[model samples]
Target: MILLKKVLLAFFGLCAGGVIAAGVYAFLAIIGVFVRLMGKTGTRKHIFLYETVIILGGVIGNIMDIYEFPIAIGGFTGHLLLGICGLSVGIFVGCLVMSLAETLKALPTISRRIHLAVGLQYLILALAAGKMTGSLLYFWQKMASLG
Candidate 1:
């Protein structure tokens, strides 16, 4: 049924979003570990690499969602708005992770605390980003309905 198809599309979109967020977080965490091992000199390079991966992952995820859904529940304006919102959420999460990493770096004495704090911050950001991405997909469904 049409309703079932819509539900499936929404589910696919959510899965794609979750995959992208996980990729971003994992990439950053790996880079952080690498930087810690390599010392301060390689930190900047690793950070840039991590950011690039996030951006690419976000783009691919959005494209995959659109391809899988292909139904506009609202209108062009709504779809555009949703896309922008999703992008904004991704960027915000990246920036938040970076800031938290910087803050953690300042307290070298509390290594375990720093790791725990960074991990928690990343988890929270991922959850927020996932929620925003889901909203975007919902808007997409609404756009499709309007058509």
Candidate 2:
């Protein structure tokens, strides 16, 4: 009975792998573009600092996502592509933050308010990307199971 249950679950997981990878790729690509465009500089220090935090956090999240999901990433080729996407987006975010941060520092007029709004965007995205990457290679796994 237990053996039968295991086989059934494996079957479903295998079938779902391709769908999951495709879905994840679409999501990551969209979010990456959105994240890249979010680097707006404001006259207020609080807003400046806030946007900086958000961009930096997102870049960090992308990196962590790559590190956290090496297995089940379809194959070496797939993993490499995913990493490239993450790095491209991350670099874009980093450049934005660095440029804006420089502006904030150069300004004499800037807010001193506490800025912690929407700082977890990257963390959440990272977790999601990791899950997608980790769930990939469903087809590969199913094939391996046959051997």
By lDDT, the best candidate is: 1
Model 2 agreement with the true structure over 44-124: per-residue lDDT tens digits: 446566557655765566667646855455766765676677666665655555445444563222222434345445644
Best model per TM-score: 1
Q: What is the lDDT of residue 112 in candidate 2?
A: 27
- Candidate 2 RMSD to the real structure: 17.0
Candidate 1 lands at a TM-score of 0.26
Predicted structure 1: clash tally: 10
Candidate 1 lDDT, 9-30, residue by residue in tens: 9999888877977886677566
Ten-residue region with minimum lDDT total, candidate 2? 107-116
